[model samples]
Target: MAESKPSAPRFAYKGSRLKPLRAFCQVARLGSVSRAAEALYLSQPAVTLQLQALERELGVRLFERSGRRLAPTREGQLLYDMARPLVEGLDGLATNFREQVRGLDAGELNVAAGSSTILYLLPGIVEAFRERHPDVRLTLHNVTGAGGLDLLRSDAVDLAVGSMLDVPADLGYTPVYRFEPMLITPPDHPLAQKRELELADLSPYGLILPPKRLTTYRLVDLVFQQNRVPYTVALEVGGWEVIKQYVAMGLGISIVTAICLTDADRQRLAARSLARWFPPRSYGVVMRKGKFLSAQARAFVELIQPERSAPRDAYASGPSER
Candidate 1:
C-alpha cells in the first residue's frame, strides 16, 4: 500500500475559527488592511498575517489583489459565506457578555470629521453621549471635508460630520444643522452699509471664497447664476475661517457661514443676509449605507435633527445648552 500523505488537522468549528474570520471579514468589508488593524488594535502586519494564515489554512486562495484593495476570489466568497454566521454569533456573544457584565454601557465608537466640527458642534454632542455611556470609548479624528469623506468610505471613520454641500449619493446624510451664508465684511466697508444685500450688490468690492469645487462655493455660484448677478472673486482660501480672517482684515469681503462669527469676529465685522433667498448651506452627519452602527453611535443619532429643526444662524447664539 502507498504511504498516505499527512493530512491537516480539522478544527472543531468554534473558537479559533471566530477571531480570524471576524478580522478577515472586517478587512474585506472595509477594503483596507490598515483600517482593520486599527479597529482590532493589531499592527498592520498582524492583520495581514491573519489573512495570510486564513488563506493557507483553507488550501485555496481567498483573495486577489486588485490595485490597493483585497477582494474576495470565487473561492474566497464561498469561504466568507460559510464563515458569516460564525462571526456574527461571536459578535452577538460578545454583546451579550458585555450587557451581562457591564449592563449595556460598554462599547466603542469612532468618528472622523472636519476640523470645524471639533470647534463648532461636536463637543456638546460628544459630551452628552459620554455622560450617558461612561463605559464606552469614544475617539475622534479631524479631517478636511474632502478628506473626511475618503476616511468614511475607507472605514477609517464610522461617522463623519461636515457640510453637505455636494455629498455623494452613496452616503446617508442626516442634517444636523443649516445656516445662511452671510456677507463677511469689515466694519467700515461700504458693503457693511447695507442692512441686507443682494448678490449683484457685491460688484464694488473684491471677494474671497472657498475653492469653486467646494459645495458651499457651488451653492454660492448657483445663487449668482440664477439671479444673473456678476461679482469678482479675488482670493480663494481653504476654509471658512481663513476666508473670514482675510475679510476681517479687509483683504476682501467674503461670503461665509454665519457660525464662523465669534463675539470678537462680530465686533470687527458685519454680516448681512441676501436680499433674495440664497441657497442655505447645511452641515450634517454622514454615514455609510449597509454598515451597522455601534450602540453609542445609535444613541448619538437620536440627537441629530434635520435642517428644519434649527436654522444655521440660530446656533451662532450658541448651541442649546443641553
Candidate 2:
C-alpha cells in the first residue's frame, strides 16, 4: 500500500486569517463586539465567530464579558498592542502604495468636522480638492467637536477641520483661517445702533445661543464670566444659521463667529465687530500625533493650508492657542 499523505494543519495560514485579527483589534479598541461589527460592516455573529476563532487559535481568553462590554485580558491587551498598528498598516497598505506610485491620482480621504465647519469653512476647499482630484473619493463626517476628536484618535478620519480652543495633548492643530466674533441683532434693536460695544453692553439682551455644550457657547460664557458681566439665555439652540434666523426675527441677539456672516445676513441684521472684546477664532486642521498621511490626505491638507503639509514631528510643539 502506498504511504498515506500527511493531512494539512487544521488552521493553515491564509490571507483570510487576517480577518479575525482585524476583528479582534476593532473589538479591543471599541470595547464592544456590536460596535466592532458595525465598524467592520459585519454581522454580530460573524464578529463573535472571528473572536472565538482568534481565541482558539491563540489558546487564550482574549476578553472577559462585563455585562454588555468586553474587557480585554492581559494577553488580549498584549495582542492588541502588537496587532493594532500591524492591522492599520496592512489595511492602509494599498492606499499608501497607490499614493506612493500615483502621487494623489487616486485614493479615499475621510475628513470629520462639526456642522459649522462643514457649512462655512470647507466649501471652497472641497470644491478645489474635488476639481483637482476627481478620481479620489472624499467622505466628510459631520460630527461634533468631541466626535471629531474621537474619529481622529481612532484613525477613522484622515483629518479634521474645525475650531479648537483647547487641543488635546496627542493632537496637532494648524490654523488655516481666522474669523472675528460678531454681535448680531435685529435691525431695530437698541444695541444695533451703538458704534462700539463692550461685554457689559451684551448683558441685558436675551441671548439666543447655541447649547452650552458647544464650544461657541462655552467661549461666550467664559468671556462674559471673565468680564464679570451677567448674561441671560432666552433659548438654547443649535447651528449658526438658526441663531441668525432667530436674531433676524427679533427673538434675541446672538454672538457668532463672522465666518457665517454673509451679504444676506448683513442686509437682514445689524452686525458689530467684536474683535476688541473677543479674540478672533481660528479654524484649522486637527490630526492625531504621528499619523501617517496618505498622499490623498496630504493633498487635501495642502489645499487647505498651501503653506504646509502634515507635519513630520511627533506632536505639535507648543500651545495651539491663537
Candidate 3:
C-alpha cells in the first residue's frame, strides 16, 4: 500500500489550541471581529478564519449577530467565561514571569478609579506605592463607575478602586473604606443650622447633584422615594469638586459622600451628616472574577488592603467587606 500520509493532526501542536482560544476570547470580549483583530494584531480575515475554525472544531455555533455587534451564544459565553482567564494568563506570561524573576522591580500597574477616589482616597496610597517601587510604572485611569466597570470587564485595567453599591456576578468587590453620606450647603444656609438633619427638611431647597444616571443621584432619589419625600434638583452637575463649589456659591444644596469633604471644604461649605437616612458608601477594590493579577498588580492591591492580598477566586467566595 502506498504510504498513507498521516491525516494532518487537527491542531498542528497542542500549543496551537491557545491561538484559537485567544482569538475566540478577544472576539467575545470586544464583540467585534475587526476590533479583536486590531487587538490581536491579526488581519480581519485571519481572525474570522480562526473563529470559524474554532467553531467547526468544537461543533458549536459561537456567536450570533445582534445589531452591529457580535453577541456570544450560550455556548460561546460558557467557553468565554472559562477561556478568557487562560488566554489572559498566557498572553501575560512573559510579563508575569519577568515580574516573578525581578520581584516587582519593573512592570506596569494599571488602576481605574473615579475622580473623587483619585483625588481624596488614593493620594496617600499612590504615594506609598511609588515610594516603595519607584521603578514600577503606574497608570491611573480617571473614570466614572460605568466607565471603570467597562475597563474592568475588558481587563484593560488590572483593577479598579471605587465605591460599589451593587456587586456584579462576574466581578469581586472588597470594600476597604466607608464614608458617611453628607448634605452640604452654603455655610449660612438654614438647613446647616439645624441640630438634627431630617431627610424631609431639605425638600424646599433644590438639590445640586451629579447626573441622575450616577449612583449618588440614584441613591439619593431611592432614599427620598422610599421616604415619600418629594425633592427637586436645581442643577444636575458632575464631579464632587464642582458640586461642592456650586453648593458653596449658594446655587443649591447637595447630598455628598464624606470622602469628598475636606477641612477646606468645611470652611467654605456647611456640611451635616445625612448618614442616618442614607447608607454609608463603601469604597474598595473591584476586580474581574477570574483575572490573573500580575505581580505588579498584586503589589498594588496589597498596598490598598494590607491585611490580605487579593484572593485568586475572590468572586467565587463572594465580596469581602473590610
Off by over 4 Å in 2: 1-99, 306-322
Model 2 local distance difference test score:
0.81
lDDT of 2 at 88: 96
Model 1, range 1-322, lDDT digits (tens) per residue? 9999998765333337666787788777777889988888888987777777777678788778888988888888888787887787777987765665553387677788666666666766777777888888888887766777888888887788766655588888876565655677898998788665656678778789777766556766777777787878898877667777788788998776655656667677887765255655667778998776766777766765543223244325222100
- Per-residue CA lDDT of model 2 for 18-129, tens digit only, reads 8999999999888899999999999999998888878777889999887878889999999999998989999998986875768587778899988877776677788889
Runs in model 3 deviating more than 4 A are: 1-98, 305-322
Q: List the residue pairs that clash in candidate 3.
A: none
lDDT of 3 at 7: 64
User: Where is the poorest 10-residue window by lDDT in model 2?
Assistant: 313-322
* Residue 179, model 3: Cα distance from true site in angstroms: 0.4
* Candidate 1 accuracy as lDDT: 0.71
For all predicted structures, in order, the TM-scores are 0.64, 0.66, 0.66
| lDDT tens digits, residue span 1-322, model 3 | 8998866447532337888899899888899999999998989998888888888777799999999999999999999999988988888989878767575888788999888778867777888889888998999998976899999999899999987888989999888866677778898999978887778899999999988777888898999999999999999988888998988888999888776766677579877777689887777889999998887788788887523322222111211111
